[model samples]
Target: MSRRPVHSVRSVTAAAAALAAVGALTAAATPASAHAPVHPRAARHVLLLSVDGLHQADLAWYIARHPHSALARLAGGGVEYTHARTTNPSDSFPGMVGQLTGGDPGTTGVYYDDTYSSALLPAGTTKCAGVKPGAEVDLTEDLDKNQDSLDAGQGLSGLPGSILQMTGNPTTLLDPAKLPVDPKTCRPVYPHSYLRVNTVFEVARTAGLRTAWSDKHAAYDILNGPSGKGIQDLFTPEINSKAVGYAAGADWTKDNAGTEQYDGYKVRAVLNEIDGYDHSRTHKVGTPAVFGMNFQSVSTAQKLPASDGLTGGYQAKGVPGPLLAKNLDFVDQQVGALLTELRTRHLADSTTVILSAKHGQSPTDPTALNRIDDGPLLDGLNAAWKAAHPGAGDLVAHAVDDDAMLIWLTDRSQAAADFAKAYLLARSGTGNGIDGKARPFTASGLQTLYAGTAAARYFHARPGDDRVPDLVGVTQYGVVYTGGKGKIAEHGGAHADDLDVPLVVSGAAAPHGVRVDSPVRTTQIAPTILRLLGLDPRSLDAVRIEHTRTLPAR
Candidate 1:
């Protein structure tokens, strides 16, 4: 069924890779050459799937052991980028944005799914930033994830663990007054408006190609872009709501398998769209030129705590163990189902399948879990800021952390002072500070580390752009800022464990299961999709700026 000629790079020596790079650079000079529309019998569609939190090592090990798994089956005739990595701050928001926009957070204006934005809340809104109407705060999925009680308001379908133990009065983040604001435009931001870059969907739609996508939350509407155009059919059922109160539905109640049920519904949604109909959308249909969905099943297992006969979370390095293995199998089944649908419709040869993930989970070594309390840190920063500006009403607006902490400060100009005060108190104190009294903070050389490397590439922003974080605290490996007792493993860091995501591109004009070791970024997926759809990759502004190139094509 393969139509593209094969080119292998599995054993590419350094010299060979260098030559390929030069070739790629030379070829990329004229990206517009690929704009010819597909012939009548040519592949006209691209299927992109992101299994959130699925690490490359996890996939490699899974494929090797479960030779018959869906990933292995696809790898048989696909181009596997073993060295594919996501952009820094590899949270779902920035990672997915990077894939579809060919830009990092610095370029796309997206930092995390839940981040502080200085833009005014959406029009016709009155709440957010506490009493300060124009302040920056979180506008994440959790805001609208769960509100109504399930089964006649008699359920608990939100927030992991018993919502009873939440600190800082988190319910306030979801309050109508604490809405998210887009700093760039100073408009109250919705999901789509939050995205600062054009997505492949918008590009494809502008070029007259149909597109469809499915993700866990409306926050993913960022993939649709600020204009919110391009997507012919979009399905977002709200996973947090579906998994509210951890209700184990009949379909997927095996340990962490409940997430599979949520993912399964979306997979079915994509399949239905691919079959030329979207009951949720209009009737103008055929297979989309670009279609995809993200699965959170494995992510559920990756964050699962070990308790009550549960051996979940990252088991060893390569071994997914029983819990994760089940989710992996479920993902495989969904992919196989998608493939079967394509074949039955005689569209297999007319479609390109790209199997990948948004980001990888970190702290695979469970023994080194370092849970830090963020309360003291936030309080210290707030005190410092308040002391500097008297009655500033908490200069630290909000703080989000995975293994790394992304803190949003109210006064951007005083960032240095804020950092200095917090650092001094943290260093002199004990407790969580070191002595356990919730010391000011840890001396992780956050500024030093952030400055020593690709700081400009990741943190560079325009002047007066409140979108940039005021202070960033990247905790040491395995050190999460929250002392929360739910998830054992988290992501959002520059660590190899979090950046290394699995990427497999197959079908249509793709090579036959060739292994590519040359370093590639998740950003390549956008340009690659444009190329696959017979569009000039250069048409994308971010791609043009980055001089991005598609993977090898013969």
Candidate 2:
């Protein structure tokens, strides 16, 4: 859908005034009053915790099995959305963006980890390569100037210059200057690039709230990368302090090696930040209001070979499944430790803790599993179709996730769409292609899926959008796209298993042990947080589903 033009402040004010005159508006548009002191000693902090790949069932099972689990305890003290779910075609990048921006793929325009679009460039650029290239330097200055410039041309079409250039280009490697230097090695370390969003930390900082984050993935660490321009003062593990990791070739498979060890060590860093009592001197009291952390060891464990078994030779009857469960328990222990630290610091009651997964993993269909031995069926189809339609330029066919494939033909000529449709149709079956769910649709079907209903709007008529997939092939449940060797499980599809995730909020202000069963999207998290903080939720596009009147009034 075409983005509604950003209205000028003058125009917005005038419209609001007109609406007020007709009694169509109230104080809703005005900024909420500063939160009044509930008790003389109420807590005013927020802690958002992210459990990588933690599924809804996982939490429910954990809580059911172990009533003393940190999550269960939190739920007893607050609320848990039993029926919480994410948006369609769920993936890590889009899910996180949905939470942070309070917008879905249609609004945020971030569909996958790698959403390629040739329209990101000017008219002269030929190739639709990955992220634009540049040094991973701070763009705060440029962004500030761009915001000002856009404010002047509030009604202009297209994004502002800074956002256009930033989004259009691929991300550059992290700058050595911004990274921490290792005293022993005298060099920088860590995977220091690959984030593309202005996250919550930045927003809190601009609002004069002190913020800290601890995360596991490269995307989370690279908050100050191109995506995290406005953030200031983030405390993390010393190992991730560098722009790259130590060159000793740390093995990821070893039980206590590589990132696993690093992650364990990193928890202390977050603990230090949380435990620091003299917030006035260290994080600045009253401003030290937001803190978040991510635990990714469980996600890493999922990636290990199924045959490896659990750590310390604890080989149960099952293969990776046993190991996965054990690892989840370990992660739960870590969370428990963090909660303990919060209580020790007297921050648990005041803090609003949000526990969720970036995305969920689908177990490999035990019935059909293999490894990468031959070309994927989609690849073969693309090759044959390309040959048939010689006029179609270098076609872009990408497998975004285990059950989804997106194809973008360079040439929008007549032959391209016809060839793709025929090729896709020919390969529809359980093993032949996308497990009989590969129904080829015209652009109209694509629009319908995106817009939800005929009344929905359509966007993406921009220059750099030519790279959007012309046809998307979806797989049914228990079906995943694989090479010669198939995977037992995968994600990145429209299936319910991959899209649904837990949404639990716990704290002093929340309702105790309440389970909400309404279907809610991940996009609602940001707006929900803003609402809890007594901020204007209108800026976001998310639909507020739950009635939050039970929350302590501001």
Candidate 3:
């Protein structure tokens, strides 16, 4: 939010015309690469994008069919990795952090967006002052001052049509009172402070390059990394807020059309950034050295159920249905718009465009869905623990359950975890096992369970680590721990379908039409971004801590 002023711009139209003229001059004066004369090998700029829930197979399927689409064009001029995997338990928080920090949950100490840390106090705990040092870290729309409004309580009521109309720093939109309190200092822990490592934005900023980013929630303030000054222009328009131009019942992720409108706001922001203006287009902040935004339309389409005769989710494995296909097309067009804008501004050749995903949706085949509510299961476990111990309150302090389950217990002892593990495994089988209802995992849904030391080791953390969960559950490929009827697919699992996402690196020093069949992780993106900008990858704290290498080149 701290920034310097730039030349005044009359209007959006004037800014576009001015940029076009400048582009004409730049094209005539210099080579395609903006800094070719000074730095021939390094790209002057890097455009990073994350298309959430875009699987590796989905990219291949789309490019194979739509040969002229934006994705296919990027693949044609880019190096596509066929087996690019995202972080395990692919929740958006750690998944995006992995790409921006060059580290996984193990090294970053970020397991999921909504997680528990025994070292932090509850939200609104003024002066922790003997208060318990344990609380759920919620990094979602719940942090918004008004989660129900697109403005996030930044302005008056009834203002609609676009989140861009909401002004001020994205971080300011989050009410500090809603954040978890740091017991040590009795201070609120903002999302940027919650991150344990530095990001590519921080590294680039340290190198005196301007940086920018756009994401769904203000909690993406995490992208700023530990320094809290990584991205100069951080644009976060709350996606979970009420949909613009729609009834109060409609939300962005609830419907495919609403999600498209939400994504369009970000696309416009990116276009504005491409035109050398801030995300809001009110000021000319100049183009950033590293900048991008994520697309949520595709992810929403892959999860939302059929409504108003519009169907979602995949028809079969690696095959998209009509609604999903339309959303994919919408994302493709947005990518094309960004690419076209880059070319129009004479920045394409000088820019390194990297397109990938934070996470992928599970059970691409809609019929594979198994909706089992983990809420009842947790309650049953608590009851079982109470019956066994006579009186222990509740064993679980918090449990974040999606397709996977990360459990934090009030009692972090190994014996307690063993008991919970046994209870869950026993109820995993068919028949009435818990709460006089059918077993939660009746269809062999639970594939793997890690508890106590096993859970600690899986995350490369010591037992009793404050941030590590006491138990981790990896469900079967088709299992999604949701009893809701609005969705057929979900993410945040260890399944191949959840972690295997697309990775495409295009333009400026990238090999064209080359497909790297080797396995790679999205964590490599941070180092690769720094490398593209001629910055040392080791400059990033996470890259150094994790020994992360730059993405492979053919």
Candidate with top TM-score is: 3
The residue-level lDDT of candidate 3 at 277 comes to 90
* Cα shift from native, residue 126, model 2 (Å): 13
Q: What TM-score does each of the candidates earn?
A: 0.80, 0.66, 0.90
Q: Model 2, which residues run further than 4 Å from truth? A: 1-43, 121-199, 217-228, 234-262, 277-287, 303-308, 311-320, 368-374, 397-399, 412-415, 428-468, 484-487, 539-554
Give the Cα error of residue 355 in candidate 1, in Å. 1.1
Tens-digit per-residue lDDT, 171-247, candidate 2? 12223343323333434322222233344444455455565555433333444433354334343322222212333
Which digits, one per residue and each the tens of the lDDT, describe model 1 over residues 1-554? 00123233544343133223113221144444234442122348999999988988988888888898778978777777777888778788888888898887777878877766554554335433443434444445555434331111223345333222222112222334335554344445556666766788887887788788887554455677878675766665555553543444521222465577667767766777678866233453777888888888787787776422556766565567567776678788899999988889898887889888888887676654556656766677667666876666776665677777676655555545355445533442322321123333346323233321123234666544656665555556665555656566778876777788988877886657577766677888887787666566676767876676666532
lDDT of each: 0.64, 0.46, 0.79
Residue pairs with colliding backbones in model 3 are none
Query: Could you give candidate 3's per-residue lDDT for residues 264-333 as a string of tens digits?
Result: 8888988998999988788898999999999998898888776436777888777898888887888889
Task: Give the C-alpha miss distance for residue 536 in model 2, angstroms.
Answer: 2.2
lDDT of 3 at 500: 84
Error of 1 at 327 (Å): 1.6
Give the worst 10-residue stretch by lDDT in candidate 1.
163-172
Q: lDDT, candidate 1, residue 74?
A: 88
